[model samples]
Target: MGETNDVTALVAEVEEQERELVLTRFTHDDAWQLGCLLVELAVERRLAVTVDVRKGPQQVFHAALEGTTPDNDSWVQRKVRVVERFGASSFLTGLRARAKGQDFNAQHQLPLQEFAAHGGAFPVRVAGVGIVGVVTVSGLPQAEDHALVVEALRIHAAGGA
Candidate 1:
């Protein structure tokens, strides 16, 4: 059910943000590397960073440790409903708040203790179209995790459509 419109919008957004060299981060090949790096940082700082990626409502991906989860960890079916209801705006706002320390969810894994502790997540959209997926990272301070995910998304989005 991936809408062509949403995918297109996401592609456009990726292109626009790709130029923000400061935002680009790790690639698919570096997912584990990024996780390790985040974990190291979390160990140093003593914080947790648990996160997830949602496509509309369905959580397409998630990275967490044992016994940790999100505040709104709804079932995939319900997640789809959430996506349709909230659109990308609400989803991104929630993810950003988690990264910014505004809406801390202690239920999720902590950075140092978790494989990858602290990180960030963002709505993946095609500029002219709409949201297609979500990118999230964890294993360091929320700020650092966010920076990495932003950069990685920009870098990864560049070659994708």
Candidate 2:
């Protein structure tokens, strides 16, 4: 790590760019699940979560994953933290912007919702219906974080929900 920038910001930016690149198109259903799964993966790993998908330049799609028995304060904070740090501009990309009428080919690609102290995110691609996005997971150890997202995607794909 040799540079003149805040490491966290740098990492976030990189993740944001990569995510934007993956989302080559946009689909309403796919966008919703992407955010939902991001939260699901976070809770699975006992981490808090919130996620959003953007279409075009300024459209924002957001969702929060809740914990059992009503509300999870920590999870709420996680959503708040992520939203505070990475908003639509920083996270949503041009692909999603351009995917308006096109058919997004990426199926149900997801992003790691957790931010790790070490940095690095799991980038998955959902290419099928003019929609694409990265499954970014962090907070937990690298492999563990990675697994959390991958597994979630698999489950969703299998369930067809």
Candidate 3:
């Protein structure tokens, strides 16, 4: 019962974040800035991670910090695929699946190799344009990865970055 309440609260929180983080517009420059902001935050915290920003199918920015490997990059790709396919944060998708007592892969029939429902990938939604891209980070625990991206997005949305 407590676990179910936790999941419910988490789902609500993530959904609120998705609703609140919508951008007015997302351009190439915006992608670059957001990506750099993610890098800066990770560096300041001494986090080992890979960050990626994409506009549709085009990747605009990517960075692999110290201690990250090619596997982190692969994780970025998989999480990005989840955000792109589901039009939501990967964390949210996974949480929703868990709330329903289902395996994300089995429920969606998406192969794990190409699509992951783990955290750290978020939709870059524009106010009038909907989801135009995704911003992803990998290397931390799934929840921490998601929180890092959310923190960056919150800063970016508030014009702090």
For residues 45-135, what per-residue lDDT tens digits would candidate 2 score against the true structure?
A: 6674434444432324454445332232233333333333444221222123223322212222322243211112233344554323334
lDDT of each: 0.43, 0.40, 0.94
lDDT tens string, model 3, 106-134? 99998999999999999999998899999
CA deviation > 4 Å runs, candidate 1: 1-51, 65-119
lDDT ranking, best first: 3, 1, 2
State the lDDT at 23 in candidate 3.
Answer: 89
Error of 2 at 157 (Å): 2.0
Q: How would you order the candidates by TM-score, starting with the best?
A: 3, 1, 2
lDDT of 1 by residue, 1-161 (tens): 34545545544453344334222333334344434444444445555545455544455445554343453232222323333444432234334334444542342322312222222444455555565554554444444655655654544545431
- Pairwise TM-score winner, candidates 2 and 3: 3
User: Candidates' TM-scores?
Assistant: 0.38, 0.37, 0.97
* Shift of residue 101 alpha carbon in model 2, Å: 44
For candidate 2, report its TM-score. Answer: 0.37
RMSD of each: 12.6, 12.7, 0.8
Candidate 3 achieves a global lDDT of: 0.94
Which is better, 1 or 3, measured by TM-score?
3
Query: Pick by TM-score: which candidate is best?
Result: 3
Worst 10 residues of 2 by lDDT: 88-97
